[model samples]
Target: MEEELISKKELLELKGISYGTLYRWKRKQLIPDEWFIKRSVPSGQETFFPRDLILERVDSILNSKEETSLDDLAKVLYGSPVEMNITLNELVERKMISDAARSAAEPFITGPTDYYGALTVFSIGREIDSGDISLDDAGTMIRSMAAAEDREMLRQGVTRLYRKQGVTFCAIISDASKVSMDVSSKLVLEISMPRAAAAFKAKLLPNKGEEEDE
Candidate 1:
C-alpha cells in the first residue's frame, strides 16, 4: 500500500515550524533525505513526506530538542550502532516484543541477543501479532536474516517475505527500491530494519526527562 503523504506547506503549517528550521533539521540528518519526497506539481514541484512518520518525527525532535543536541538526536533517530545485550525475556518485559513473537524466536536464540538480532525478532513478532504472517513463515524470515553475512545490510536493509507454491521465502535487500521478485512469487511483507531499529531504540532508551514530571 502506498504511504499517505503530506505536502511541505501543510507540514510546516501543521507543525508550526519555519522552512529554515525544517531544512536545518534535514541538514543535521535528524530527518532522512528519503522522507523529503519531491514530485512535480501543477505549479512546478513540491516536497511531501510520509504523513505519520514525519509528524511523529517532528514531535520527537521538538520535544527533545531542548535537552538533546541535534547531532546526538540524529544518531539516536538514525539508528547509529549502539551496544545492547538483552535477553528474550527482557525484550517482552520491556514491551518490545509480544509473547507470541518471543515464543517463535526462543528456540532459535542460543544466547544473549544484540540490538539487530532483537530488532529482527521484534519485526517477526510484530507481523505475527498483526496476523500479517504466520509464526512458521516468521521462522523462515528469521533464518534468512540471521544467515545474512552483511550486518550493515541487515542494519539498514529491508526484509521482504514472499510465498510461492505454498513455500515461504525471505530476502534482505539494501532498500525497498532493490526489491525484485519472480512472477510466480507474491510479496507478503516488507519491513524496514532501520525504521524498526530507530523505533526500538526510542522505546528502549527514551530521552532524559521524557518520563519525568514537567
Candidate 2:
C-alpha cells in the first residue's frame, strides 16, 4: 500500500515550523531518513514525508521538548538502547519478552541480560512458535550466527531478520520498510513499521493524552 504522503511545504504550514527547523531535526536524526521521500512532480522534484508517522513524531518532539533532552528523546523515539539492562522478570512483566521465550532462552544467556539479548530470545521464540524452526535448531542457529565478527550488526539499534530459501540471517537496519536489493531481479518483501511492530507484539509509547483517561 502506498504511504499517505504530504509535501514539505504542506507539513511546514500545518506544523507552523520553518524549513530550517525541519532540516535541523533531520540532521539530528529525529526523523528517519527514509521518510524524507523525493518524488518527481509535473513542476519539479519535491520532498514529501509519511503523513501520519511524521506528524505524530513531530508532535511528540514539540510536546516533550521542554521537559526531555533531545538526546533522550531520540532514544525514546527510536527505541531504548540495547545497552540498557533489564532482568528476565522485568522483561516478562513488561511484556518485552515472552515467558516461553525466557524459558527457552535461559540456557543461552550468560551473566546479566540486556535488551538486545532479550530481543534475540524473543525473535527465536517467534520462529519456534511458527514451526519454521525448532527450539534446538534455533539455538544452534543463534550460536553460529552470533559467532560472526559482524554479530554486533544483529542487535545494534534496530535489527531485521532476513529469511530466504530456508536460510535466515539477521542484520541491523535503518529503514524497516525498504529492502536493499542491488539487482532488480532479486525478490523483496516490504513490511510496514506498524504491521511489523504489531506482529512482534511490541508496545509503542503513548503520545500525550493519547491514552484513555482512567
Tell me, by TM-score, which candidate is best: 1
How many pairs in model 2 have backbone atoms within 3 A of each other, for residues 3 or more apart or on separate chains, i.e. clashes?
0
Q: What are the per-residue Cα lDDT tens digits for candidate 1 across 1-214?
A: 7999999999999989999999999999889898999989999999999898889889889988887899878876774765567788978887889999888887777588886788889878878998998889888888887678887777788899988999989989996775557999988898988777766656654633432343
For model 2, residues 123-143, the per-residue Cα lDDT tens digits are 666666666655555665455
Query: Model 1: runs farther than 4 Å from truth?
Result: 175-182, 205-214
In the predicted model 1, the residue pairs found to clash are none
Enumerate clash totals for all models, in the order shown: 0, 0
Whole-model alpha-carbon lDDT for candidate 2: 0.59
Model 1 clash count equals: 0
TM-score of each: 0.87, 0.57
